[model samples]
Target chain A: MTSRERAEGPGDGIPGRAEGTGDGTPGRGERADAGVPERGERADVGVPGRAPVIERRLHPVTPLRRAWAPLAVLAGWAVHDPNAAQEQLARLTDTMLLLGIAVLVPAAGLYGFLSWWFTHYAVTDTELRIRTGLLFRRTAHIRLERVQAVDVSRPLLARVAGVAKLRIDVVGTDDKDELAFLSEREARALRAELLARAAGFAPETAREVGEAPAHVLLRVPPRELARSLVLTGATWGSLCAALVVPTLLWLFTENVWTVLVTALPLLGTAGASSVGRFVTEFDWTVSESPDGLRIDRGLLDRAHETVPPGRVQTVRIVEPLLWRWRGWVRVELDVAGSDNSVLVPVAPRAVAEAVLARVLPGASVPAGLSPVPRRARWCVPVWWRGHRLAVTGPVFAARSGLLCRRLSLVPHAKVQSVRLTQGPWERRWGLADVHVDTGAGKTVTARLRDAGEAGRLLAEQAERSRTGRRDAPPDRWMTAR
Target chain B: METGSLDGTGAPADQPVWRRLEPGLLRVRRLLLAVWAGVFAVAAGLLPGLFAGPAWAACALLPLVCAATCWRLLERNWRSWRYAERADDLLISRGVLWREETVVPYGRMQLVEVTSGPLERRFGLATVQLHTAAAATDATIPGLDPAEAERLRDRLTELGEARSAGL
Candidate 1:
């Protein structure tokens, strides 16, 4: 069966596969039965089983997709410097120009083609092995059980070419393995299979796991996204600097050109960044599937990110000063191994809370957090009142920032370490600060507590973390179920 | 020195028995400081002497005085450094004026490294660095006997593996 599929061939010259392998091929005979056959049979449906050894190269359009960036850059440079282009063209004869194009274009294409040809990925029962590199010859074997998350991202060029890239993030590793330029449907299928395998599912049920029905939880409209972006502190700060600084300069120097020159770039940068956020976060949707939370976002470069169960390290709910009036807040999750961590770009307070509840069950931002000691006001006079913290049964939460209120939550099971620090001034005031760290960079810090209270909290939190880990579900969540 | 015992626990097991860094660390530190002080004193005296007169060579006294002050400060700082091995976690306390106490659980340890630089090796000293998933965790116990450092690494690694929990 594997040889037959191999003979069927890859890079079929079609930019994308229409439909060779849809679903429901019981290739379970070759499956290595690790365990849990009962649950596998119950859950397995419409899943295309994997052969004993499945190996294939990336799509044919990968070369073209890879070449698009440099070609576009060259075109942009030529357009920007028309005089330079014309001068260079005039110096060369027609034959020389043709020869140059012939040599350069093929050379670039050949390089892309060779790199693509050398890249081969294979999936066995236990691991996904990728072999690439033309000269050095490197091979990466990622254990299926260690797969953390699989992301399918389509940049503008790849989207146009009807292909996508699959980025595989594994446990305890910073580097991501990527399979560049697969047909969109194939990428989705592969992602599902990999995630299922990671979750300890049999090969017969892996494909169906990807097709599990998802319920839409929240969707941010384009209008709300625009309004939220405009209200952000960065936008306001940039606007004020662009307008106020230049106006002051004009008043002092009385030069209109200088003001224009100074303000243009600042205004351009601010406007560009805001628009970039808008483009990236457009049509942001959060949906809950059996596998995990599915975040499908972006306009120009669509990305489908799956945050598997038990992977969220911390959740942050931020309400900017201006956003408070509109009752809008942004919810961000510190998901392990994923950079696009914004769970919801903008939502109402209640909606954001609801989404948080979905992401981290039995967790919420508690009301009436214990405020810092009054004497600690010497450190941060204005924001000390807002620096509050609470320890719930499931999570430890800290609230800070008077101008922009932020509530950071870390699950007890996710606490990596605890720290209690006291500066000279804080010690003088008989106060200390407590920090609860997670795998992600964000930490929940309870600042300016009584030193004794801080010590007790540290000990209690360590105990809680121990119990939490003892009771926490295993990495293979499906098997536990 | 037992400033922050949790819950005022009376049990000796509950109370952390803090251990101080090796006394040899102070000697190594003083030697390192002396070398730096000599280099700075020479630069101060020679640079000004080249531009001005030999009278400016008195500036050499400035680094010596500063080094003297730091010599006392280094002892206090070194004395301030201490660590305790608890049931589930390790507690490291340091800093003279601004005290910091870090609690890292065995389950959270990702890597533990034992390293000895040339000077440290010359003095037969090593440092044990503990790493967790959190990058903010700066847990280092400097200036231990080389044999002790290895033992700590092995014991920590064993505990970490036994209690390993995913992030």
Candidate 2:
């Protein structure tokens, strides 16, 4: 059977009618009064104030094609034993059984090939229409206005072929599936068209950086990448193993091809990891675009993701121990309705601090808020006390900064959970660590060079944790419960 | 644990008595878990053997392993598990090595579902699951008396409805 039939037909459990509209026709509800313009007639003209919902043709993966794969596998298996001519002749002895599989092999293949051939998509001034089917034909209709976020990802193979996949996620619609697997050119065009539609076509008003813009933030350089390779344990170990082990193995076999296949993915992984470190170390940038903030990273993919600032629910800044010496911090933002967190892998101390300031301006901890005062506290675990710490008179503090260091303020309103940690090594050095998590997942962590102050801080924060709310109250509204 | 008398005021006349866990039941649960673990280890070791080498003894061990995994997961900390209604939330604390404490505040609870699997039904026990907006954050307090589970469910539902109406 055809993929559309499989997608829409009885067994799949998805009902016949499409997403929003009750009937097979596209326009229903208030959309009927929307006065959707006819295709190609002054394509830009619709309701004067609002952007027109351009209906474009989108093609989805065919079920016929998905089902054809198994048949192709069986066919390939049957003819795979080329050296055994007698066996091949004997394979035909089971003619009745073979006929059933062989007939499906060609029939399904022809159907899949024909379905792909006929699939066509076009975005008109009014709506997006995708029509594909072999026998039981169907169309997928999506109103351009409802689209929420557009994500584009290209595998290495797709990159070589100059083809990328596009996914258009829409809000308040149960279409069961979004747009996927479009060629790179087609994907870019779709993104641009939808973004333009969302922005409502005020040409000069469009943000310089947005979902449609190709401008990127982080790019990796070579020298920094090599340094990062030596620093990263995983990368360093693999490279050393690659150089030494292969030389020993080469004595057994002169063949270089066997060594190459095994070495390439590992070398590529180490190089990619080193490049990631380079991007994190140097040329880190996050800039405000008209639509949202554009985050760019990677040496290869050179990805650009636009996060609408309004959607941001929480901001997190993390400084793990290894990264502290290099003065690097990772920043992550949590947005509403999304399960995934958006992150900037590596930012210089100043850039990370600035980004945190913009995203979480309320994260200023009052100096006197803590009952016990401590000088420059390091946000390290107690087990990691070999790191430096600073103390001023009565207060115990540990200070660590990869580059530029800033203290995180978890206003009483934001505090969620407070935890204290210590290990055998920490006990030996008289050090203790304290971590206070806010409702936004932002943590104000301090590893005291002196154990006494870390204990006091942990005790004080635990008392505050009882009243921490889901959202940080405004500074003006901060109240002690 | 002491049962407190209710007063006309919100607070009870007397606080409920809290006791240390009964040691004998705790030991029994630990013994059961140990057996379950032993079964699981044997099963995991045999799974790869099924695909590569067909040993009848290893194949025979599969069912026992599956049963042990399910049994251990169901009643890992049977006796030490406790549920107490604090000022705001219902707290569930259990487990031995990796202890867990989950607080289901009345306002955040979406629904309270009390379910009984066959083994639970045979034991006359019920589990109340408090679903929240986030799937991962939901809490299930297992092995409660049937009547108590129903009462807790009623209280949670009433509070949830009141909170939804901005009370």
Candidate 3:
């Protein structure tokens, strides 16, 4: 009748649950094994039922976390110009801080304790409930069946303390209500348990872990990283000047020691940021597990994100002008999760094509699937050409990839709005900017060097969009109007 | 949903013989903006003395400051003026430098709102904002007489709901 017996049931292939405390009643520890439902006659019914016990655990951010703040205050006192006794008093203050670490720390601990007390969460077999607040409490219950993905994450400090946060995303749940964190071991156990339980809900039986496709790991070489650094500088040159100029002015008023203490960190951060961005921004890997793909990267702390195939809405291939020569491309996927899109920051254009083909194979391109005037094509001409040309047929045409180029075919159904805009120089040169919105969530646009062509493109796309909506059910008021 | 030559201007074919700009209405708006500009100029001239430290700076900035207020009032008057009804949608163009033309299809309109501010009421004018599902695309026609604003609201409401209902 326990979770162990349920795992042993023929319907599920997951490992048996750990034993609960020897008492008949489920203990706090048993609640740690909260989601593993016992074997039941309902196993054939395929409904995930609850485990007998649940536990409440505090977040690991305790009073001991504030040890540095008071130490900082003592450090400030030590540097102040004062008599010998006064200076000694400052030194004595450090010892006092250490002694009061018992009482003072717990006083600060009260804030964290209240925060933990105010937060409450429970994960049963069927659903997860979180309730927290000081004045106006909020309670959110998410059905486990609707969960799209669960992200378990921890910063370096939290990892040292062996605790991590859990963020579970469901299709329709609001952003704030979908996240909860448990300790590191507990989070892993909970994730495994939840994934295992979700497996029972699958219409087909569960397969072994390695049954999924092998993951493709791709890393950008150091040369490519250096190139990315140069590109990042070009893109953010103005922004860098804005931050550095102010700090340089501030350094003059400070003492030599003070300037060194502050400016060193600032300089170090800038250097690290440039290097980290180069290291992390474009290094991409795609690994497939039974659950879904795990995409991991970052400059400081690594992020491992799992995206199930069922939640994917659209796939986009992006190619910016700077990376064009290198044949580098980036791929992002729109999925139903807390973060709307998954960024594959950097990939070789060739590698990206293979990945996109695997994830979204034969998905009809939105632009090319329609007839003329129903789809739009946007084009920017080369320098050698006299003018840019944008042509819209019953097809949507777009360029894809970051470094190299590939043509993207978006269909008419995806086109939302068409716009034509021209500025002073553009008008002088008879050029216009054209943008098209697609149902795929954001604006996809192309600028044409020629105004006349831009107008035609706009008109054709607008016409296509109108025709696509013509078959929609008529409103009741049309006759009366 | 189709982009056309409507441009929020009434169809050139449907103009009424007497629908030209009313001289009385135009004079009233111009007078209001003129008075507003005078009041802003006076306030700008006086504010510098209220603060300390080389108060000449505020005095020097007053005319440039007054220019902004004058321009804003004049621009509002310009944008609030409207001139259009076409076959499919009601066209309204408003705004000063950043002129905007909005088309509200009789079928797409959810409701018509008629509102009057203190200044508008004193001028015997009211503003009407037509509501639609595409929130950003709503049409607002301002600077109409109370009588005409009400009439337009009713006409738009009747046409909108009827078109919405497919009656």
Output the number of the DockQ-best candidate.
1
| lDDT of each residue in A1-481, candidate 2, tens digit only | 0011111112111121243322243332334334444432122343556553333333334333267478577577766655574576566657766887789778877876776654434453334555555565655554443333445655445566566655443332343343434656667666666455444544333223234444444433455445444555666777777766667656767679667766677677666566555643344346554444555444444343444423343455556545677876566565323333545555566766666555443442123322212332333433332334332221222333443333343334333334455654555556655654433334445654356766665544433433333343321111221
For residue A78, give model 2's deviation from the true position in Å: 12
Query: Clashes per prediction?
Result: 0, 20, 30
Candidate 1 segments exceeding 4 Å error: A1-51, A72-90, A171-176, A208-210, A240-265, B1-13
**DockQ for all candidate structures vs. native:** 0.32, 0.08, 0.06
Report the Cα lDDT for residue B150, model 1: 79
Model 2 alpha-carbon miss at residue A267, Å: 3.7
Q: What does the lDDT come to for candidate 2? A: 0.48
For model 3 the TM-score comes to 0.54
If you assessed candidate 2 against the hidden native complex, which CAPRI class would it receive? incorrect
Candidate 1 has a DockQ of 0.32
Docking quality band of candidate 1, CAPRI definitions: acceptable
Ranking by TM-score: 1, 3, 2
Residues A194-307 of candidate 3: C-alpha lDDT, one tens digit per residue: 554453433222212213344655555556666655665343554465467556756666556655666566655676657656545534456766556666665445455665
